[model samples]
Target: MTSAFSLKRTLNLARWNAVLLTRNRLAFVYAVVLPVLPILIMLAGERGDPAVGATSITTVFLVVGLFPVYYNVLSQFVSRRDELVLKRMRTGETRDAEMIVSIALPGIVSALVISAVVVPLSQLFEQPLPVNPVLYAAAAVLAVIMFTAFAYWTAAWTRSAEAAQLTSMPIILLASLGPLGASLADSNETLARIIDATPGAAMNELVRVGWFGFDGAEATEKTLSFAETWSAAGPPLIVMAAWTIAACSLASRSMRWEPRS
Candidate 1:
């Protein structure tokens, strides 16, 4: 049972998150401007050659776009989680769940905005609409949840706000450079198998479905036929789910209400 007042406060906090994000010029650029730049570059470049197909371009953009939105936002949120602002909110009527929601609201909104921009822009180059919009949406939402939780967990271990950016580098780099996740989403059986094992690979697969319609059967066949190895993409989804749970559990157990002791 939730109260209207609590909901209102949560909404207000969400809005405040957006305002605070805008105030930080660096964060604003990281969240908004950075993701779109590559897309523009791709659009302006040559649109020929199967090597640079719609599927590949979209896959690249999706992966590139998520870095600034997910990594930066998560790092920022986690870095600030122990600030006086969060401490003050925790002492008030704001529930822990609401606090988390409020903290995440800005990133969520920014991701949505970035997606809106990317989808149409990709379409302008003749990329097909998602075959399964439902699954695509599910993957996108799950990605938001997974990365948000991961960021919080990372923040819990982080020593300071400055370290937030540094601490987040591994996940960011992995998401960017990991095998098959972004690079092999279109092809490369070996890479795809490797990507299926990584943390954020499921979302990469889902984005492929959105951009190029990757069905379960097709994915399974691709794995079996080309890769000659059964990928754990399905299992990776489970792993991602587990990551969500683990991140939440870790944050609950170790998250400091204020700066380190």
Candidate 2:
């Protein structure tokens, strides 16, 4: 095989993973049903309010990010590594980056596909199309990449596929902090900043701005044009980029090809 990364091989691996995911009932529930169920519930109660719809959109991506993008990848990588699957792949034509991306591709694609369906579904509840579609697209892509990297980094410390559940809680909660933590941290600006700095919150902020054109602090009546939306997105974009870089660095440094045990 040539030293060049093989898209064909990566795609073939991704297809296999897609099939495995569909065949495994529990994984199917985790990857597809669980991420989408709550969003549907939220949309049902939207009452034609755009804000509610926007929030539903944000929640959809956040839930998908945590479950399929982060947790599933972590568990899958750990299981594969413990099985010596990752080790075997390294001895073959699979490059490290290709192996990692292919393993993550299923969950990543699941996330994007679910988002595509749900975004349109939200419209049935009277949710308007995004005010800044660019931001939504950018946030989704960045979030998937960020969470995929974080999953690999988390797998480095995960002892087994089983242990991934326990190891994953901190990240799950952190990604989920959002405005709930904001309410809790209301008395403490420092805590609020920390919560907003999380990868999850950054992505949520992007979703909010993409849909509403203004964040919580800004006036609800305020509307920004496409260029202005980018200005408003600066902080969240910084937070996301920083987190992705940090996660990628740690994953590269500590990721394990063999079982911890």
Clashes of 2: 0
lDDT of 1 at 149: 75
Clashes of each: 0, 0
Tens-digit lDDT track for model 2 on 1-261? 558888998999989988988998888788888888767655467467665666677788888898788988898889999899999989987888888988899999989988778767776776667788778888889989999988999998999999998999988887888746546566888887888888777887788887667655323433777788888999999999999999999999997899855
Best by TM-score: 2
Where model 1 places Cα greater than 4 Å from the true spot, the runs are 1-5, 44-69, 78-82, 177-194, 214-236
lDDT of each: 0.60, 0.82
lDDT of 1: 0.60
Give Cα distance to truth, residue 34, candidate 1, Å.
1.2
Report the C-alpha lDDT of model 1 over 33-146, residue by residue, as the tens digit.
Answer: 765665654466555322233345444444533554456656566556646677777777788778777777777767666665655666666554544455445556666777
Prediction 1 TM-score vs. true = 0.77
Q: Compare the candidates by lDDT and give the number of the best one.
A: 2
Global lDDT of model 2: 0.82
